[model samples]
Target: MIKFNTKTNQRSDYLPAASYSLVKQINSRGVYSFCMCPGGVIAPCATKNNEIVTNGWSPSQRNYPTANSGIVIELKVDDFKKYSSFGPLAGVEFQKNIEQKAYKLSNDSQRAPAQKLLDFMNNKLSRNIPKTSYIPGTVFY
Candidate 1:
């Protein structure tokens, strides 16, 4: 099945503006790309307790149909203020809230919420979900 990751409307090019720019030491958190898997498959990342996370993996031969990666975004300490009741453990609470919400949306199972790329872009529900590599299954949104 085809998949598109980003929600942006702009088209992409082999070469684009700002393609060779880098800014450093700005005292602001930056996003980094990591957890890349080449020729891999998406995997269900969930606890037995029912939290939905998406991860990816490849076989020992690295011969899967797709690739996946994680874009890590740095969160400053100040960003945890909304979760301050738990104090320094706010980040944990924040993550828990996300997992809990996902479980609630996915019928309290390990299944993760999903939508077809076109339906997502059109802001409508997908009448049919394409086959996925994930084994835990998906709950279409």
Candidate 2:
């Protein structure tokens, strides 16, 4: 991102550069009319907390049925405002590493370590399986 310090951080206030009308509505009017801005337009976007933050939407228009929705990656201060010593790219680096880790962890290769009831019964626990990351209650290991 362009690293905004404030709404007035003024990379010019209006994107698309050539357009000033949007800037007039947003900056001059002071009423940020974000169109159906995701979920709440603004939620607790916490990247440092190892949370998969997100939001969603459904329209009231013809193709819009009011419905439910769904929702990454690690990000640290060092990788953001610190490491790489490159300002915003630090955050990019952090996200890259987190994505890599997530991909590696999720590579089940169509054969996760699940066992049938008979197999589970036949085996005794000599090593501990990891705690499942699934929500609700994870199955017993």
Candidate 3:
């Protein structure tokens, strides 16, 4: 019954009509404002694969559009239920696993698999583990 057209009607490149108008109003000669940090400090946001990363920018200083691209894979309703073991908290669960694995391989209790400066220089794992990123939420850990 559903036609499922392959064609898409995407109108937004990023900003909407009203947002563009606001920037037009403020681009004056004496504005003298640069290095404009919009929502400074990166946040630990994840993509579909759950690789945590941060994003932020400085205007005038960076001298470019405050934009960062993300690689996202599309999924359907069936995709949501794909991971049979992770019935509900799939994303959170996956992060915990990463931390735990990284933790056991880590030196300190923080739970992030880490190597020492000398170990890194020697290209070896340190016998004395240093630190980890695993927080209190790792129930399985």
Candidate 4:
């Protein structure tokens, strides 16, 4: 998931809220954006203990100062082959593993692990992270 500070962009304040969908192929993998929300907040949506998952949503008025979205990569069954021993539940196990790992990375808290967009693209750790709409907060990683 990614988010941008809408408060810095004056145009976003007067324009109607919008959502976007983007699809592309990179390194033979399908990458796409899902549940894009203008003037939205990143929300925690974990369904189990020792795990973390996130989603985004906007209020009816969409007046928040941030916009966020989930960028997902399409996964094929082969992607979860490591958990194939679980049969049909392999994908579930794979997803659980990722969520649990994220939880651990965030110091076993609700705070999500995060890196600035530029730092991430540059493959470096962010020296600081700006404020975000995530209620539980975020920890630069």
**Best by the TM-score measure:** 4
C-alpha lDDT (0 to 100) for residue 131 of candidate 2: 33
Q: Where's the lowest-lDDT run of ten residues in candidate 2?
A: 64-73
- lDDT of prediction 1: 0.67
Model 4 gets an lDDT of 0.80
Tens digit of lDDT per residue, candidate 4, span 53-124?
Answer: 988888876777687876677899889989999999999899999999999999999899988765865789
Q: Rank the candidate models, highest TM-score first.
A: 4, 1, 2, 3
Listing every candidate in turn, what is its Cα RMSD in Å to the true structure after a full C-alpha superposition?
9.1, 19.3, 19.6, 4.3
Task: Per model, state how many residue pairs clash.
Answer: 0, 5, 12, 0
Residue 92 C-alpha lDDT in model 1 = 91
Which candidate would rank higher by lDDT, 1 or 3?
1
Model 3 lDDT, residue 24, Cα: 18
- Each candidate: what lDDT? 0.67, 0.32, 0.36, 0.80
Error in Å for residue 44 of model 4:
1.4
Alpha carbon deviation, residue 61, candidate 4 (Å): 1.3
Residue by residue across 48-132, what tens digits does model 3's lDDT show?
3323333344333332323322222333445445455787776556555554554454332332333454575476756774222
TM-score for every candidate vs. truth?
0.60, 0.25, 0.24, 0.79
Off by over 4 Å in 1: 1-34, 71-79, 116-129
Per-residue lDDT of model 1, residues 11-43, tens digit only: 232211122222333257675556555556788
Ranking the candidates on lDDT from highest down gives: 4, 1, 3, 2
The candidate, 1 or 4, that scores higher on TM-score is: 4
lDDT for model 2 comes to 0.32
